[model samples]
Target: MMHKPVVDENERRARQEAHLLVREFGAEAPLYAAMKAEKAIEQKDFGRCARWKRVLEILADEPPADLRRSAAAK
Candidate 1:
């Protein structure tokens, strides 16, 4: 039997939160998160930077709006 990798609870929560943010704010959500990450880098707040970077990573994996629309229209 093949076993699926276990997801950490915090990581799962972050992904869910990122998706909700993207849905609520639309395409610019990732852009905003990236800007924050850049600001964090300037401030030398590596932890905050890491969190925002992770959010961008999660956002990158989300389906594009066009793909979602096409699938829905099918």
Candidate 2:
């Protein structure tokens, strides 16, 4: 019989912290939200993906001034 490997305490704590960050920040944490969104997409979970996309939309940063000005000039 194969024994289960032990979980490292620090790694566990870090995972917990990351989970908390996702819970607290949702889409405001773009990297975390994007990761979740990608996972959702991979899982074919459209609803979950849409939810994450909404959060991403809400928290998306404005374009830089130069980009905005160039677009305006077009």
Candidate 3:
């Protein structure tokens, strides 16, 4: 009989956290919004980029409690 290798607890937890991130932020609408904004920056759309940059700044500054918990759990 062949046996599958066991996953480490930390690795299992990481997978769970990754799933949550995807669930929370990987919806089509939100992903499209972020991508569109990022593309605007790439195209030298400074005005749009500045606006999107502020949005990103807000997201970056406010790390979710669940994310923090996951980091601390590691």
Q: What lDDT tens digits, residue by residue, belong to model 1 across residues 1-74?
A: 99998988757655655666666667877888888789999999997787788878877876547324443454
In model 1, state the lDDT of residue 8.
84
Question: What RMSD value applies to candidate 3?
Answer: 12.3
- lDDT of residue 32 for candidate 3: 41
| 24-69: candidate 3 lDDT, tens digit per residue | 6643323443675789878988766555554444344445454445
Better of 1 and 3 by TM-score: 1
Ranking by lDDT: 1, 2, 3
Error of 2 at 63 (Å): 12
Q: Estimate the TM-score of every prediction.
A: 0.62, 0.45, 0.35
C-alpha RMSD by candidate, in order: 5.0, 15.9, 12.3
The residue ranges of model 2 lying beyond 4 angstroms of the native Cα positions read 1-28, 61-74
Worst 10 residues of 2 by lDDT: 62-71
Tens-place lDDT per residue, model 2, 1-74, is: 99988867644443343344445554346677678889999999987787666545534543234223443454
Best by TM-score: 1
* Candidate 1, pairs of clashing residues: none
